[model samples]
Target: MRAAAGKYRQRNSHAIWRAHAESASHPMSEISVSATSTVDERPAKFSASDGTALTGTWFEPSPPRIATTVVVIVCGAGIPARFYHHFARYLCECGAAVLTFDYRGIGVSRQGNLRKLKSGMEDWAVLDIPAAFAEARARYPRLPLGAVAHSVGTLLLGAAPDASRIKRLIFFGPHTGYWRDYGARWRWLLYGVWHVSMPAVTKVVGYFPGKRFRLGEDLPRQVALDWAGRRRPELGRNVEEARRFRLILSRYREIRAKTLVLSITDDAFAPPAAARRVLSLYPHLVVTHETIAPATLGCGRLGHLGFLRRPASEFFWRRAAAWLITPNVGDEPKTTTQAAQSPNR
Candidate 1:
């Protein structure tokens, strides 16, 4: 009986799935990692409920092991899908299929007039995220579906009405854009530039030329307004945004998934206070929070975007891979904070 119980637990642990994705059947798309392992990258196109065309790439483990689950890598605002390809490939190597895509008006999905595109941050949450979820479900009907969202991606995930379909979730450097939540060293600079300068310039130019300024990708007018305008004591910009705030507040309860929230210690946008605030929204989730410093990874900084830049062989990357395969042990939200020290330490 004890042996049987151990076997049951092992199955529940999701240990059965761990090799990264590949496709030997399609030699043209196969990426050889070593002599025996390979990952397959394939182009995918889907449409949001609003009928907006979206393009994505699928990284799948091939030959020896079929993926037991699908993990979608949700990008932060203004970040291209390619930024996550390395991480997706890492997850594929670890045994799950991964999908990474750009939101409308960004990366591969960008088209038409930037100033004229009606895709806002809200539209991304309501339409694009769900579309990705649907795409994953359609491809792997029996496999468990999960997501790893970065920065603003968490906000978008919580805002998605169909986000509950996700079996598991990981929010990296999660936070709402509260100016006060920024690190003191970068607080006012980020505020004056993102809020005061960017929004003002966005209005004047009809779109934010972030590509020119090195802030990030060029953004649609509404996306810039929706992001940069989230400030002061209240995050809502107007009556429409006030409604969205309330809607997202409630939808957080609907997204019932085992979540791991990873926050960097000195993340300018998502400090401990901000991470805690975002936690308040997800009353129904089984959340486990961890705060790590860049020093632990032997780096000088990991402020906002640096976490994604880190090599996938690192401890935190493996931590995320383990979480993707781990099932819920309980219903409680555990803020079991830990500082991830280097393996050398």
Candidate 2:
């Protein structure tokens, strides 16, 4: 068993290395990472409920007014929290405290020789997200909290057991029915590859290289497994977990917080119809929806992940700032004060 595992590991590792090399040789020029402005503040590392240390940066509002509310930025599959740095800073500048963190066993938080087990989206919903939310609340107890989840993070957040902690929720490019949109054949093929083959391959090969493991880039084996096997609702991390994509559809009605759903018209991962379905689930909740055009934003045929990548990102941040600061009864009292103070107009 050990020898077989070793061989599989080596093969998968080599495959990842080759892909990484190829990507490096011909890097895509869609968005330049350095193009966006940087946040001057450095992130502080903190421990989660499971004792896993996580990295996060807190953005204090500009002009340092008394903070009215705080925003927690949750990134989607495989991405590090650093990708949301620009957005977080924009929220802070608009007078809302912002906290962005890397989920456990991914990004910089993967340090300390953590075990590489295959985890599903359910694990994130049950363990990582809840712990992160709890930590954010503990750290900023005095301030009302809002959450902005992107992609897979949206599913996990939407399924959270304690949605009351969040005053307002925003979903950016949420993945409502990924498997269906990708086609049944593709879904089955992925299931066979990721579920039946990947775990066995990973067991034999010590670790899968970063690039081949996309969703939670550089994700641990356990996380990858959870993501792959996350078909049945019963297989989710928490017992009360919403089972299946249909369950997610139904649970939206239970989300008590004011919500906003944002999607790009050209986003392949989340089409306009999918965004509409998500909103439809929450008819009673105060909801706002917007569709961004890539051409107008100077983003060429931008899709799901483009919102954070580059030149087009300015528009996304601007929209986010407006949505977050706009005074609704659900907004923090201080948010109203900060909006009034803004001299940008």
Candidate 3:
């Protein structure tokens, strides 16, 4: 009986899932890492909900051991998954399989012409997420699944139909992007970026020229329009749009995974308040929340996108791996104060 218990414990310890999301609003350069060093990464292909062939890279653990968990890194709008190669390889080094992919009309998922792309925000949230989940499950059957999302990526998970399949979730700088969530410090800048800058650029190029601005990859016209429209408080106040919003919010109940929400103190794109608001939508889930000041981590001014890169990787990334593997950290529901007590540490 003791031996059996020991075996069970060994299996259970590694058999957990983690999903991570970061708020999307910054530039991400291509991640440079040794391709054959710690992980065996290769280009992979999977089908989207509409049967569109989506391209991705899979990072499998070296030495070829059975993986107990799989990590799916979801990108924010206009940001390709290639920028997350380092993060994926890091997770692979931690003894788990990792997959990163571009959503439709972004990065490699864009097949021929960009001008004719008809995808929108809803397609990304509802369809692309489920497809990614399906691919991960197919590759690693019975293993606990995890996800990491950036910016709009987290919102997409909240809107996914297969969200319940994930056992663990971690979101970095997750926000719904409603204009009112930001404070005066960033309101004008955000307004100019969303309403003025993006509109002018999209009008000229027929899509958001995010690449030229170093905001990541260029975006489809409808995707850009959808993001711009989200700036309004009511999201157009129309009956159909209002109903759609209700539907998306209602899907949060399906996400029963234990979640950790990380917010940076100085993130102008998705501040603490915005993170808190996004968490409120998932009232049914047991979520642990943490607000980190970059100074505390010695990673000076992490802002919105710095956490994914180096410096913070020393402390923050390890903590994330720990939380993903350990289910007891946030097993019980706690208040915001209780959740902030360095449980991940």
> Against the true structure, whose TM-score is highest?
3
Better of 1 and 2 by TM-score: 1
Estimate the Cα RMSD of every predicted model relative to the unseen true structure. 9.1, 13.5, 9.1
Candidate 1: global Cα-lDDT?
Answer: 0.74
Query: Model 2 scores what on Cα lDDT?
Result: 0.58
State each model's CA lDDT, in order.
0.74, 0.58, 0.71
Point out where model 1 deviates above 4 Å: 1-37, 311-313, 326-345
Question: What's the lDDT for residue 83 in model 3?
Answer: 77
lDDT of 3 by residue, 235-312 (tens): 344788888878776677667777777778788878776765566566555666677776666544777776675555
- By lDDT rank, best first, the candidates go 1, 3, 2
lDDT (Cα, tens digit) per residue for candidate 2, span 1-345? 000100000000011111111123423322222444333466767765556567777776444354567788888877888778767776766667788887776776667543544455555665667666776677678877788999767766765556556777777886533333322334567566555666675566654444565543666666655555544423234555444544654444466666666777666656554454344444344554556666656445667776665555555665666666667633432211110010110
In the range 1-345, model 1's lDDT, one tens digit per residue, is: 000100000001222222332233531232324575568889989999989999999999887778878999888888899887877887888789999999999999998889888778888988999899889989998999889998878777877777878888888887777777777788899899988998899999999999999988999999998888777545466788677688676777676677777777778888765665565566666666667766556556667765555331244567787889655433344335332211110
Instruction: Look at candidate 1 and tell me the lDDT of residue 324.
Output: 91
